[model samples]
Target: MTETLLLIGILALFGVGLYGMMILHNFIKLVIALQILTKTAVLAFVIAGEMNGQIQLGQSLALTVIVADTMVAVVGLALAVQVRRHFGTLDIRALSTLKR
Candidate 1:
């Protein structure tokens, strides 16, 4: 029962993240949406490991995912900063329009 609820929650989080990614035009918002999607995947992996009685494996994988996500976030922010420096805005549409 609890596992089912967790799965449902994960699905909801994925849906929200997908929606945010599709509807938001700002680079920062897209980054946040990606983070949310990453979290949903982490949660699903943890829940599956728990159900299979592989807690340690799940934890280690989750930790690895956290590290990878952190690295991705850092790189993404650096790129965003560079984009802002060169373009003066984080709006995706505006940036696209600048391409002549």
Candidate 2:
């Protein structure tokens, strides 16, 4: 079924994004991974509801998630900028090393 395939794709994207988040050392990379993971989760919710013929709750939740994700992305970018400024690099390891 298309629904099943959609679910699987969503799960794959979520896992891949998390993996990227874990392996990436750059602040920007982490932010991008977080965003991708979140959007995939949101997509899963919406897709699942559509498949089940009950879309109201999913749509409402997705709307809220979109708003939250937007705010989080803005804040995250600001934090990244600050990190770049303080350390002159976006690499988290380098930032940590600078503390010594």
How does candidate 2 fare on TM-score?
A: 0.89
> Could you give candidate 2's per-residue lDDT for residues 11-87 as a string of tens digits?
89999999999999989889899999889978977986797788998888888888898888899899999999988
Q: Estimate each model's TM-score.
A: 0.90, 0.89
Alpha carbon lDDT of each predicted model: 0.88, 0.88
Give the true-structure RMSD of model 1. Answer: 1.7
Tell me the RMSD of model 2 versus the true structure.
1.9
Q: Which lDDT value does model 1 have at 39?
A: 88
lDDT of 1 by residue, 18-85 (tens): 99999998888888998998888888879989999999899889888888888888888887888889
